[model samples]
Target: MLYQPDTYKIEQDLSRFGRTGNDTFIPGATEEGLRQYRRLLRNNINNTMVQAFPISRQVLPDDEWNELINLFFANHDAKTTQIWKLPAEFVTFVKEKDYATLWGKPWLNDLLYFEWIEIEVYTMPDIEAEPFTLQGDIRNGTIVVNLEYRLIPLRYPVHLYAVEEAKNHPGDYFMMVYRHPETREVLFADLSALDTFTFENIAHEQLSLSDIAAGLKLQFALSDQHPLLINMIAFVQEMMAQKLFLGYAVERKEQF
Candidate 1:
């Protein structure tokens, strides 16, 4: 009887070969061929990471970045089959391993997240928008916003400042990332604490301008509402111009 290796063991060894450059388990595989295969796989992963995180690549020194990628390749068992999603795993790996603290870059996680959001927004599946009207009384109607959007709160102002500068100015930073409806381009806007709170309410709740103004007045102890409503209407108009605000949600009439 001929000797045959277990198929499952062979599969495991093949995976190990990619990570460790070891080819001893295969019957006829050459060390040189396995080395080439490993190099090719690693290079593909490196390229993907580079494309996804250009900012992180620029910030880290060549040696450190190379070492980090190598560590990730060897240590992490990626769950995603799509190569484009490997960077997302890399971000998780970095956070799990506390690479930022090890490398003395406190803003590293925020930087990685900021860069990743652009890719995420660009590649996210399309969302169907509800019926809306471009011309309506925004204050009276339920204001509609772009469905494909994300709000991220970071400890560092990485969106506004360079990594080095961001480290020094660590505080609460809110970023609004969205895709333009017509352009389909991922865009980012910085928000104040108040703006972030207000935008969150608008996105999650069916709040008209009057409702928002009333809530703000109650929350902030404001005596006047006219100026606040005026400013908010102007803000909504600006957002509509940017395609972030998709006018107001259309109210359907009841059937007889």
Candidate 2:
């Protein structure tokens, strides 16, 4: 139905209820109305948040989760008309406020951020790409990594902290979230420091694999008086197989 006077009033009432949980101003709205609205809205909003931040949700207790939901409903006045984005707004709200009272989990926000980015990567639109060759000279030819990839150097191993192995092991980590161009499937890689160094060199501008290897050796890719060419080659091959390395370009030599 289009926004008529009565419907507009009802919308206003619900908006108010969304932020206050009180519907006394709503004409003929009873306590039952408040109860039902609160339940439905809270459930839907919480579900969205969970879908966006699954790791964080699983770690929180029921009461703590409910508090987080209530806090968002009462505090957030979202700018987006789209309900799908409420979870992101909730994350923003948490960033501004102190949710430590709910739990002393210091890693919660970082984990939430990582999980949220997975959803974002999954839903992000793929751009039209020109055809390219994945096989080329790694030593000199320009290389192109997939445009769909984001190299997130996370402060925590939030990508794998849900597992038991990462329980005791913690350090600087890179969470590589990307989507396959052909399949549209979202994939993630918890990269090593060396992998991060190599990945940083592949760009849309096209840097050669050898140049990347050289840069790494000059900076940190060396091991016991020699550059780790073997490791670099293996990593490059894996990335190519995984479709992370789109292809390479050989610039023609200038004619005199």
Which numbered prediction scores highest in lDDT against the true structure?
1
| TM-score on alpha carbons, each prediction | 0.92, 0.80
The C-alpha stretches of model 1 lying farther than 4 A from their native spots are 1-5, 22-25
What would the TM-score be for candidate 1 when compared with the true structure?
Answer: 0.92
List model 1 lDDT by residue over 1-256, tens digit each.
2446577667678778888664456767777877888899889989999999999999899999998898999899989988898888899899889998998999999988888889999889999788898888878788788988888999989888898999999899889899998899998888777667667777888688888889889988999877888877877788788877898888899999
- Model 2, position 104, has a per-residue lDDT of 57
User: How accurate locally, in lDDT, is each candidate?
Assistant: 0.85, 0.71
Off by over 4 Å in 2: 1-13, 98-102, 163-169, 216-226, 250-256
Could you report the Cα RMSD, in angstroms, for every candidate shown?
2.6, 4.1
